[model samples]
Target: MKPSLQLKLSQHLALTPQLQQSIRLLQLSTLELEQELEKYLQENPLLERMEEEYAPPLPGTNDTDSDTAEASVNETDTATSSADDESWLGDEEDSNYQSASSSGSFDDDDGDYQDVQVATTSLREHLTAQLGLMSIPDRDRTLVQCLIEALDDDGYLTQSLEDLAETLPAELEIEPEELQIALNHLQCFEPTGVGARNVAECLALQLETQPADDTQALALNIVRNNLDLLANRDFVKLKKLIECDDEQLRLAQSLIRSLNPRPGSKYAALDARYITPDVVVRKLRGQWTVNVNSDAFPRLRINSLYAQILSKQRGSGLAGQLQEARWLIKNVQQRFDTILRVAQSIVDRQRQFFDHGEVAMRPLVLREIADLLGLHESTISRVTTQKYMATPRGIFELKYFFGSHVATETGGACSATAIRALLKQLIGSEEQKRPLSDS
Candidate 1:
């Protein structure tokens, strides 16, 4: 142990602070990166966020652009207030706007945003609104309203009329026939298929409103009895059973396709997810291009007003903070640059997917991209994970482009995505009698 000084050689791995910061920034999502920058801005006196600048619309733009410019001017006009008034962000108004723009109303004045109120209505409410317009007797109206309440979100009264009659108070002496008559009235509501107990009746109710032609009669009979034949797309069986020709069967099929299977789903309050894409891709002049979304990351700069004072006053003990600020700025730039390179490489390899669709996607792996970019597989994973790319098709994550390979019949390989796409196409087009199996 005492002779340890004797010549010995060894190697040890170490990560510099700058390298650690770069890796951390690379792995962060757009929202996480924005939050991280906000934290740094608050802590570092030398760092500040630059204000966003919106330029005027170019001349000779489309009418849509002109409308948007006018709307922007209107927004500015409506939002502006005198200096003595409350600031735009601090509006104390209790007015309520709608969560959706077209649903409800509220005033947006003095340049301040108002809290929006949720204005969703359930199936029951929608039916009740129409029921209020009826001039039926109070007794009949009550029974119809009860049936309306029984209807589910898809506009189907799930319970049978017999079950509904028995569920009513025995002292009221209600009968299943009365409930049936009330249901008939409910079925004739604005949504033609509402209040039906089953899919067959739902479709039949809708077909009842169409022109009373031979085609409508055939369609009505098929929905009420041979609905399964239609679902299986058995046109030959339908033609044989209904004693109809090919054109009549085709017309009936088209009529069936136009029916709403879930009539009340339009009123369902669907939750929407928002995503901020890190990169945007577009085909420019017959060439695919990848560019960083500048708005995805906050613009940061060194505070010249503060840095100037620090420079003149020597030994202010802020040199470490100043160095840290510079490191953050450089690391942020490197993050976007790495993301752009990786995204561009992915788009180049999957260009077929952009032109055609998922079926044309080629097999890809992280190792292949890492080797091409001369970086580690871990770095590629970091660049792909949680980072999204906006393309003409839709917004997709960077990792969505890479997948495992599936062996093909030509002694080659296909991407799993392409295989799945092909399987889906086959399944959709497969004949009912001879459907695809695991084999």
Candidate 2:
């Protein structure tokens, strides 16, 4: 093709390195953000955490000023005062401070070691411990371990015997029948249903371990054949199919319900995460108000002494570092500012939820908040993803307030959250003798 000269005008977006970092930090959870901050502290010499004593006091206050200002503000603005009481970048001196601290020597030459205890165990480890006590041949033990590895987190053996057999080492020359025997032995292990192929089989394994009785027999039969009817709560059909009366059916169901569907879960280690809410909501003078949680954002600042020293030395590469440090501090402040704004908007729209509970939650969308705040929908999503708000009702994720709209009878729309609340209420008040049917 011949060279052609043409001018085209178009607009597109570009994300700079700092902008990309800010966006990534905005979307991170509280734990992840803390980790990111630690990484920055290690890499950037100019960045340092602001200690409580070293932090600057609030505006219009002096070191010699009595508690008069604080007392007066508390008295006049009881509702809004507490919400806006603390500085976002100030170290917490109050008893309600939730941050943890450690006091210990970092010297490795002291020859002191602390033994930390694990609070949870995994399913595989638990099963393997039990396997160690079994009096089986090494070959059989190896086969059982193979089967144990195949069990899912829920303790269900999702793969078939034929499929599992293919996974064995070629030298083992194990058949499907041998694998089935190994699985049978594994199913007999503790937790009751570690090797069951399906929900029915899992329940059956538990029932087999129980003492033989009428209820046990009936439960086994129901689990084996009429599990669908039982699951549907079709007491009438279940009675006909299992040849049992209402009382007997209820007893059988009680037995079945007592069985653990997910036996492996109890042994699974919990990956628990503690959240510090980004904002706090409280009723201030009969009006809901939002306050940014001081603990959620770390107290960060550019070391003034270091900056001054670096400024004295020209062409030392420290100027650029100083600028970067300032940019980071500013970006961190802006991140929380955006979070606070988004949280405030959510609190304003979800006031009813604060007043009455989740049942009063209205329909909301990211677009609505984005439009109101003059931000992009993706930015709103990032702000709301890992952010949380603590209210009088309870702590909830910001995204919890946004739901798909459902049409109401009056041609308006109801939030799926509100509909779920209504459904839960209906189900809770449903009659025991006659459960409500889906209409």
Candidate 3:
């Protein structure tokens, strides 16, 4: 074979750091973004909360004026920290402070934060607390600890009994039934569905607590035997299998629908983490307005103290430090600019969806917005990934706007969001006693 060289022009996606950050921020839920910001603040030298002005505003203006005057006072005044001139760029002088700062946002004064009410104990905590109330011996308690560790966030025991048994201490041989008993006990906890084996079992656990009726039984049966039918909207076969008329079938469907498929998920178990919406939407005078949720986003500014220190590098031949400082400034600006641009793009494209609701959501894709904003598709994807926008419909991730296209029966293109809305509406209006079943 003769060696040949050919050149062709083709584009392939390459993952750049900035694009990665954009995608990461896009899909991040509110909590994830907070953690990310905390991570960046720990690692970077040039980022900090803007220092408060030393002097009060003009004498005549009351604190109420202070509220309206500062459009950017993100949170309630009570949560604001007193002015700190020193920036948090890991102080090299004190190793302990440096170690503490670099690990994450750890402030000695946690008093500045608002008290966010967390509903339930974490899965491990819930199990451990229950374990304490049990009459098990110390050795068995140790075994129970191992068992609890094997359980996943959804409260289902992800690890097999065999795996857990193997992990147990060789001196104390625990039977599988003993492990089963511990699991059964965990299932009886306040959250109800914590120790389910699967979604079917989870729903069954919840339904068992409800009133004993045909609707409940039929729902249980449908979930156990005809999960496929429920997912596919195959109401005819479901009705035939369950031996119910249209109205009864509808009731059964409604009953089943009301049951949380992932029972342990509500708060006790691990559910999908949702991003905080950056912008809030409200309607006034029949017009929609997008207001940035300034509270969720902390006021980020270039750390002047750090900048001053870097400025002092003029006489010293520390070229690397100067270059690093410049990179930090540029990256910070790019991060904010990208976020703002993506936010604006979302507001522009999803305005109708906000005004009219999900049914009116136009078919959108990452490529469409990427082309509009002169960014790569992946960049748009990342930018929208975990980021949220609070609209009149409630909080939604930015990526919610970029729905897959679904063709309607009337030959028009619709978004998956639109279809979901249609599905919800169909289910909502169907005769509750006899719902439209899959036929």
> Top model by TM-score, which number?
2
- Every candidate's CA RMSD: 16.0, 12.5, 14.9
- Ranking, lDDT, top scorer first: 1, 2, 3
Looking at candidate 3, the ten consecutive residues that score lowest on lDDT are: 80-89
Tens-place lDDT digits, model 1, residues 1-439: 4655567799997999999999999999886888889899999999987765632222222223121100011221232112112122122211221123344345554222322222366667878999999989887899999998787667878788899898999998999888887887898896778887777887788899999999899999998889877766677887889999988888887777666655665465555434678877878789888877655756677888878888998888887888999999889888988998999999999999999999999999999999999999999999999899888888888999999998978999999999999899999999999998977
For all candidates, the clash counts are 1, 0, 23
Kindly give the stretch of ten consecutive residues in candidate 1 with the minimal lDDT sum: 67-76
lDDT of 2 by residue, 1-439 (tens): 9999999999999988789878888898776889988998888888999997776543222334211110011221222111122122122222222111222245632322321111245678878888999998888888899988987776778788999888888788989998877887898888887788777888799899999999999999998998877776778888988899988888888777767666665454445456677777777789887766666667788888878887788777778777777778877778888888898898899889889887898999999999999999999999999788777677788999999989989999988998899999999999999999999
Residue 423 accuracy (lDDT) in model 3 = 90
lDDT of 1 at 389: 86
Error of 2 at 422 (Å): 4.0
Itemize residue pairs with steric clashes in candidate 2.
Answer: none
Give a tens-digit lDDT track for model 3, residues 246-277.
Answer: 98878876666665443333334224433455
**Hey, what RMSD does candidate 3 come out at?**
14.9
